[model samples]
Target: MATATRRSATRTGRTTGRRRRWTAALGAVALLAGTAALAGPAHAMAAASAPVDFATHCVPPPIAGIPPIDGTTTAQITVDNAAPKVGDTVTVTYTVTKPAASNPVDLALPADIMTPTGKVALGGAQTGSVTVTGPKKNPPVPGKGSFPPFSMTGTFKVTAPGSITLAPGDYNIHTSYIMELDTPCTVITPPAPVSETVVATDVPGANERSIQLTTASGKPGDPVTVTGAKFAPLADITVAGRAGAAQTADRTTVKADAAGGFSAQLTVNDKATTGIVAYEGAAWSAEKGAGPAAYTVIDDTPAPPNSQKLNSSVKAGTLSMSQAGDTVALSAVDFGAGGASTGDLNTVTVKDFRGGPAGWSLTGKVTDFTGPGGKIDAGRLGWTPACTTKAGSPSTCVAGSAGVVGSAGATLASTPNGAVTGGEFTVGAKVTLNVPAYTAPGAYSGVLTLTLT
Candidate 1:
């Protein structure tokens, strides 16, 4: 009998990348059609044994989707031989298809044989385009493994028929192989592909900080001013607002010498009754915010003085007078008194017009008066009377500019307002009136003055 071969295995397949000569192995023919003799004295003897069937399987399914992106081709192998006896060695062989074939799928094993019934069987994996190497004498028949070529077909055969002696139980064989792309694949780059990013741009600001106007509210015959700050010189002014009129520089304008601001004027009647004045369109350069922001033609014409406050002191001997009127109107009229400063006792003739003695006497501690700094000044207006008496001091009542009744021609007094007269009461001014000999007492009156200061 042939002693079991000490070492043996053979695998072969066609390789597309490598031009190696193809090797072929005859796969084990299927089980013998007729049954072999049952194991008895002869059957269980070293010569009595049944041929084993060969099977193939795979792990990490080759066709499955994963890292490979494409499936792999590979396979595991198993063998079955029953009734083997000791003292017999075996050889196994397998064949795998060429990688070039789209479905080149196969694997093979060689130097295979059944082991003695009481001996441990051999098992393992066989993979690669070429035959895989395994334990020297097929160690134990059934074994497991990991392989890559995921999708390939395989078939195998067991040579060394005389190597195995005998066996009682059915002996099995096993081996594994991998599946990988026989034909390499590559990706082609896309032609003319485009990528883009957007960047934003910012816009700068313009001129024009603010705009305001004085007396923007007025009737058609009344006044309206288109005013604001940072207004350029000779700028065009319009009032399409209430009365709606566009006035050019020379015609409807006011300019500054070194001052950068100016004023514009317009008038409106019932046509300008609307409370709103969508007045903008004022242009400027190098100003804050946007240019010419719209402005409401507000009734800047100060509400008629809510109440006029008069500031001054009166002496029984010193007479004085003052007047207050529409400042805007006053500024325009500038009615200086009759040669005398405004509120500067124009015609100091006492009269019932306000208060005086029985009839009215123009003669008092003072007759005519004047002032500086828009203040009323009087020298000849006061009289050193012969009466003396001081409710607050030593008893003495002097006849101060005695209260007297004069003829109608003597009681007349008149001093127009809006005149650059009197002392310089720059900011705010006051006017005063007195009746030397106020007949029936309580002297009161509403006096309007249009003075120029």
Candidate 2:
């Protein structure tokens, strides 16, 4: 009886083991079916795991004339703040009406983050859209689980890009909705774009230095005022120009005020000619910038050789044989002018109206002589220099006056010629004829000339 019972138990165990193995295989098949239902098509599921194929996923149809979706669903988007400052946080809210019954919908917020020029992904852009899918349900009841009359809020932060600068202007944010997953039935709505203004505050230490002049024109030895701003604080400023008199200082130094402002006076160089000059000022240190002030330096010195004249008394004198070895007054030459005087006999005024203070002298001679009374001997004429006097009278005889006069017709008394001082000089002359006891004598005439050099 024990042996028979044992055989019967073994047969039952064998049958039960086979049944358990079959049940476990059925469960594996069910699990695979559930996974397939949860995921979409095989191709779409694979594509999601790889780098997005922008050609199909990102590209959208032309917005022109596309009919609006005829569903009960409606969407609204709102940003926490329309005008956001750089480096601030932004909150975007998306609200939707009841979604369609057949298709699962995806709410998308594509913050294009465009610039004024409508370029994307630039100018401090914290871009790319955020997608919120329908809520997960155990056995997703056809359209009941995550479909609309729903409100979804998403938050993103905007920060000034380290590589790009965010200009202060309007930046656009766009909103969209994906109606169906990986199907032609998907409807994307482009809502009215929202704009946010980016603003910046003032930064310190960005001021540049500049300078200006009080007047536009000046002359040598003339004073000029210079004003400057935006220089280094408490800096030593040096002003230089070409508008001062000869042997006069033209450069000056002054310390800038606490606010980096300064005003100073400088003279143009005395010898500066008539033209333009770049009057400049700068600080000793390079931290303080340089400023240039344009100035016109004019020549005020007048043209030379104001006035001159020649006078002679020999033209009115009488030549007679009775005056032998006796000296007579020939002529008195005088010079005085109303112009710049060097207070010395340093001028030899010329007929060309040019004069210099090089000290002048007078020379007398008989250039030529001929008349109805016949010509006198050329060797018989001589002259004596008179001392220069304010009263026009001889006070002292000029040096070399004696023995310096000679009978040379070309140049008479040149060696002993009188020196011109203070623009005035004069000379007296005498005539002597070698009258022999038997020589026939008649009236004779001759000419005398005086030159100033």
Candidate 3:
């Protein structure tokens, strides 16, 4: 009986192993079916191709007898993808057929020199225009017999869900030789007969992110408040300001809140140009994550004062000057066979707040140096002046030439009358004193005065 029980247990174990294998196979199949269900259905639309003809009126180059050329051209347009979801990009190709007409005059059509650019009108679900451009692949035409056929491509993003129709519109052909010659061609009459259609499907929660700005205009060093919404929660986002041709160097990164929203601030660059700057926010993992807020950079230069007669009396502004220190001490030198001693003079600052166009000047005068060795003439003291004007100020400061600062005084710096916007200016100099040989040993001191007007 015991042996029989052992055999029975082995048989049961084999049966259970087979049952587990069968269950695992069924589970694998069910997982695949669930994945397919989540994917829904295939939404890709078949590619479409069509032919279009245009009755073009082209303005040809000026030759004594050559007038405008009215001709018919053929093109084949192919939509790479006719069905795209919202936020998807689609590419369309425009292939032109070589014209049979001969050149009116001898023309050298260099490779890639002839460029064609035009817009394709959109209808149906979208109401806007898409720009198309072709690479410079035109074969060199020694004396144009018939223009070669070429292809151009354009791409646009699907913004809305619906059927979008494309119709060929106006375009221009540009050729450069001795002078730039652009032939503007217009589609004549009944419009282009051929048109292509694209269907855009809606993707839930796609391209819903948005960015807003607190202010639309600012000057350099100004702060701009940026806010973002409808982004992924806790997502890392980068926000930046961009101009048409210039890019701002400022950017900030922040984390979205639990509600899929974020807020940050960015400062404008000091050298930013005046134009419409778009502040954009983007996230790497999010599709169509970029959103733009337009900001204009206004010219910070204050407008000129309006000329008006005031009924009340107005106080006049003032121009003033001050020195960093009261006195300048030269390096002590031995009197035995002396040559010269030099030291840096104290810095002098001049400020002009007067709102008028009248300019000002700064002068420096010195008294005779006196000590135990009698006195030294002030004319013996010379200085090389250095002048600097404040940054971003319209004022232009000119330093005075190197010369002796005697009792009569000498120019240290000056501003021209063209400086309508007064600003602060700083002046510095290196003072030198010439001592004769066999001079008596003693300490000398001199008083220097600076005057501004």
Candidate 4:
């Protein structure tokens, strides 16, 4: 008795859909009811044995199509083989079915092939010349006939440390009995196929990149900001030659006051002082793919000192003289009212230094004199003196000394001087001059500029 069933064929289906219909009645009868003679001393005998049908199937996993990732797929394949490395080895299961006439059996395998540059290099050949075999008993299903599995196996090894030029591929190869599993036969035979590919990371290609930052004038201690305009987000930054935190970035926004941009504050470190400075971006091929950018550093230092460099100033002015032959005559010297005249000699006396010179004193002999004398105060007077042909002249001042060679010097009788005027601060005392009968004549002058400072 043959049971009838329909075979469904759907191509391009990655998953399988199975349909089973059970028989409610086998046309069997109760031997007890129909029998007296049928059961005379009932002994049992074995019914016709239905051979087990091993199904044949072949399928492949989907290949990665995403361009950004460029990935591939892997699949697991099993077979009913007489010499299987794994799986049930006890019973040699077999399958029998008619091979489809249309769509000549297609042996699908992985497209991933390993080359010297390929992803895998196991040491075996680049292209596999593998053969798949099935069991010897290739019979039809139950209603058709009984048969054992068609088992055959091909063994190959993948050996490579780094991939010899190219690596050998890995696969779960199986013997295929390409037949319609949709058949109504008691055993469905599927197309057995082996598949595998080199699944490994190729030695990553070497990579690199850089970024640059600059100031209008690359001067030390100048405030300059380096923005990673060319770099994408998540780029590392270094500050003042000091390595910074990972990928310190800035935010982007369209708001009016939005602070959109990544910035690296560089204080211009001494180490980074190259007369030129730059902030750079480099190989950040992490997430996806991209190139690198570099920057140069500039140094600027020779600028003149600021106008506010020194904020204070000082000026000096005074009036003084030394003793001549025998008389002393005082003329305008450092006229600035900056200091005082004091000692066992005399206290500082402010006097008029305008319209004439200061007065001097007499020493050894009377000397010729000129210029009108005016009372600087009650004590000091303004006057000028000159040397005369004769000593002991009534109009001349005389000098007094120790009678020694140079000791017979002029003693200033009156040397014109004055107190501080126009915000002048006094310092030391004044020198005295003496008119001498033989004193030399010469115009001595000195500037006395006083300052509020």
Candidate 5:
């Protein structure tokens, strides 16, 4: 008879494989449970079953005279609800007809001492692993013999409308006595064919709500326009912005119009840090619905030369503009006799989501450069504009001609009146400041205002 200590020693040889098996099984179980909780409401229920036979490789106890075991396991899978709705949890039963490998020792296996855990790989409409655990139900084995086959049950929720394919993966068996014996088995190469496919359909009258931000990035205390659509008509809604543990300074509750839409302004918290703020709107109903939009918070403090500022503005029914910062700083340069100092302006992004043929333009103007030595004419500043449209845009972005941009302002970029469409365009410019021969020697600053229409 093999002593308990000897059996424990033999188990040590497969420790690595056992650890991997349990980790995968537990992770799959957690993923399945989380996904199920997020599903909406289930549709009508149905039932179906399929037979699966697959080859497996099992690592037997490290007995001096035994080798690794290879065998076949056959099982039948039955789905209780084959056509579930988005939020419905479906039950599945797996019945085994044969064990992958038999016990190689003459140890008496007691009743209710054997437990089995199995895994099924999912694909298609959803992707993840589903774990099935069986209760301890083995009959007393008098001596060296085959493990009894048993049935296991598991459940998973359908998260979206599509076809999900289920296939057998791997499994493990544990028998407890003086010490526990774990046998890890892996599916052979060229995995078994898909066991079954279940279709998950959407709930009736489920309309998806959406939210969009006028500008996607801004500084603290900046006001952002939040627009929502496709909500329940006359629904009371609460819109909030959150960035990690911090919440926006402004939160609004409003009533949706007859068309199931609403608009409100949210102010970024004055103490908010730089990060992405997610704006979410929840509609009040028996079954609440929510939509999300994202805004990036940026630092607004002025830095040394070459530092950039971001700014953006959007018209309610037309074009939208976003910049990298609130201020743009050109690199400091020593003024040479009758020479010029130059730097590149930060890029500005303009997006047309209005789906119209009416075109738009961007222009910039600068205040006169003022310092201890007096003032330099704003007309001394000139720029060479450049424009690039995103691939697939219907509009042709025309760069503005290089010229002086005085207080009156100048066109940085524009689109033909008939070429406007839904797309994004970025505009930038190389700025040159003409220095007078006898200019004063103090630092000077000016404000550059950008406008989009």
Candidate 6:
């Protein structure tokens, strides 16, 4: 007897011809099952007439000498979205190569269309059209080969229904050959069952927003532009200033174009303050909003003219000292007596009027000193002075010894323009006399001139 066995082994082979062998095999099985009743004993008829035992198998176990079909078929599954969110229509696509004809390709997904972890549940899967992608001239019908080495794609859509979130997991596509299990066809070998897994990454809901303005600052009545890239399509944008009041513009409302890009210029109001103004915006149809861009409005009024005024209240009556170190402190009144007074001292009040210059140079020059009898040395009389910008403020002293002013006259003090305030300043002085003990005692006087610039 010659024993024939079917088996599977990787082998390179080509298709020989097309035939209808599967139908004949079915008919032969039907004949055998029917004749069993007549040939068997009456008591065993029902059992004997049972259908012939032909276990369904695909690419059967390898025979002793025969080789398995060659030229492997490869398929890859892709999705429009790597991570699908809830309520998103996820597209699952299959690109297949070297597909066989006369066999139907079956794609099997999880029965419930839910994630393996049971976190996400889709509405259901819907199969879309299958498209042939090869042969520029005329594409072959997918799985009905008229061309060799061709590629085709099948697509399906899954809707992530309402709020059931799909957690992170692998969603697999199971594929197999339906008809090629029993009936073999040339140019078609049932590819071994394979699975392709797609990873889930996001839970569907609200998306984050990013929006901004080109420039933050502008003067009153000037144009400031605003832009947003993530707003809803064709949505209207409303802009406002610090008070949340809608900004006045040539166009108060601007709409975002189809791609969610928006741009519009708004003018700062004339009544705006000289300080900073913050701007913000919102899309009419959006759940979120954007920005507080700071803008500054400046005042542009000119200032007034300045003037400088000087007054002095010195108790300049007489000078008398008992010893070389003896000092006579003169009482001096400032802009007013109660206002400011270096008691028993001399003080000059300096004021800068609206039209006056900012600063001045003061120099004290003394001529030859004279007494009731004859002349005395001018260097014998010296003074120390200090200045104060405000009436009640403390005074800052000039760098000098207590008795240093001489016949030639020295720079007592020099002040910068800003050291004075409220258009006024005050200068206080303390005078000291250095007299030889043996010198004749008599009334003495000297002319002191003050030059102000």
User: What lDDT does the true structure give each of the candidates?
Assistant: 0.21, 0.29, 0.55, 0.21, 0.57, 0.30
Q: Candidate 2: where is the Cα deviation over 4 Å?
A: 1-218, 221-355, 367-376, 391-400, 403-422, 433-437
Q: What is the lDDT, from 0 to 100, of the residue 134 in candidate 4?
A: 25
Ranked candidates (TM-score, high to low): 3, 5, 6, 2, 1, 4
The residue-by-residue lDDT of candidate 6 on 195-228, one tens digit each, is 2322233444543232333333333577756555
Candidate 1: stretches off by over 4 Å: 1-204, 233-251, 256-259, 270-453
- Positional deviation of 433 in candidate 4, in angstroms? 99
What tens-digit string does per-residue lDDT give for candidate 2 at 1-453? 001112111111121100010000000001000000111121121111111111111212233223323333334343332333333233333343333322222322222110000111113333323221111111222321332243333222233322222111111111122211221112233212322222222223422454545543444677867666666677777765422111124577778889988888877764442111122244222133332232444334444577422211101111010111211222211223111111111111112111110122333344222223344344543333333323431122242253222235222112111111122233333333322232222222233333332
- Cα error of candidate 1 at position 89, Å: 99
Q: List the residue pairs that clash in candidate 5.
A: 40-87, 43-85, 309-325, 309-326, 309-327, 310-324, 310-325, 310-326
lDDT for each residue of candidate 5 in 91-208, tens digit (9 for 90 to 100): 4555677878777567777676666666666678876555555655678766668888876555454556778777776777666554556676778874566777777788755434
- Top of the candidates by lDDT: 5
TM-score for each of the candidates: 0.15, 0.21, 0.38, 0.13, 0.36, 0.23
Q: For residues 73-179, could you state the per-residue lDDT of candidate 3 as single tens digits?
A: 77765554455566554555556774423344576665655556555666777654555555444677677455677555554556678878777756656554445
Model 4 CA lDDT for position 437: 27
Please name the candidate that would achieve the greatest TM-score relative to the true structure.
Answer: 3
Q: Which residue pairs show backbone clashes in model 3?
A: none
- lDDT (Cα, 0-100) at 312 in candidate 1: 26
Measured over all alpha carbons after superposition, the RMSD of each candidate to the real structure, in angstroms, is: 59.5, 52.8, 34.1, 54.7, 29.5, 46.5
Clashes of each: 111, 11, 0, 84, 8, 20
User: lDDT score, residue 39, model 3?
Assistant: 11
